[model samples]
Target: MKAKVLVTLKTGVLDPQGKAVQHALSSLGFAGVDDVRQGKLIELDLAETDPAKARDSVEAMCRALLANTVIENYSIDLVD
Candidate 1:
């Protein structure tokens, strides 16, 4: 089984890195770049095949170490 985890900062959180990137893009002559936000994607290869079990484990992983729930939200997707 394969799992994809997308972790991103929640709305209303200040994203300095994103802001810096946006500024850099604009300075590079990239027009109309209104905003930029950065996030993390984690891909995991698992031995389990059951979707339900994989989801459970992935969620656990997110809560435990993959994501910082304080300022971030994460979604998990399971694939063959």
Candidate 2:
């Protein structure tokens, strides 16, 4: 099984890196980009075959290590 985890900051959290990127874009003349938010994508290959089990396992990974739940949120996508 293959899985993908997307980790991103909560809406109210401040994102310095995102700000920098936005500024850089404006400097480069990419206009009309009002806001930018940065995030991470994690890809994993697992031996588990069941979709339900894989999703549960990946969700556990997110809670335990993949994300900072206090300031970040994560979503899981499973591909067989």
Candidate 3:
């Protein structure tokens, strides 16, 4: 099984890196972009075969180590 985790900052959290990227985009003339929020995608291979079980396990991984729950939120996708 494969698990994909997307981790992103909460709406009210400060994102200095995202801000820098936004500024750089504007400077590069991508003015249509009004805002930018940066996030990460993590892919993991697992021994579990069930999609539900894989998702559950990856969610726990996010809560325990992949993400700081207080500042970030994560979603898990399972691919077979």
| Residue pairs whose backbone atoms clash in candidate 3 | none
Better of 1 and 3 by lDDT: 1
Candidate 1 pairs with clashing backbones: none
Query: Once superposed on the true structure, which residue ranges of model 3 sit more than 4 Å away at CA?
Result: none
TM-score of every candidate relative to the true structure: 0.97, 0.97, 0.92
Residue range 39-80, candidate 1, lDDT tens digits: 999999999999999999999999999999999999998888
* Clash count (model 3, backbone only): 0
For model 2, the stretches where C-alpha displacement exceeds 4 angstroms are none
lDDT of each: 0.96, 0.97, 0.90
lDDT of 3 by residue, 1-80 (tens): 98888999999999899999999999998888878899999999999898878788888889899999999999887877
Model 3 root-mean-square deviation: 1.0
lDDT, candidate 2, residue 53?
95
By lDDT, the candidates rank as: 2, 1, 3
**Model 3: how far residue 73 lies from native, Å:** 0.5
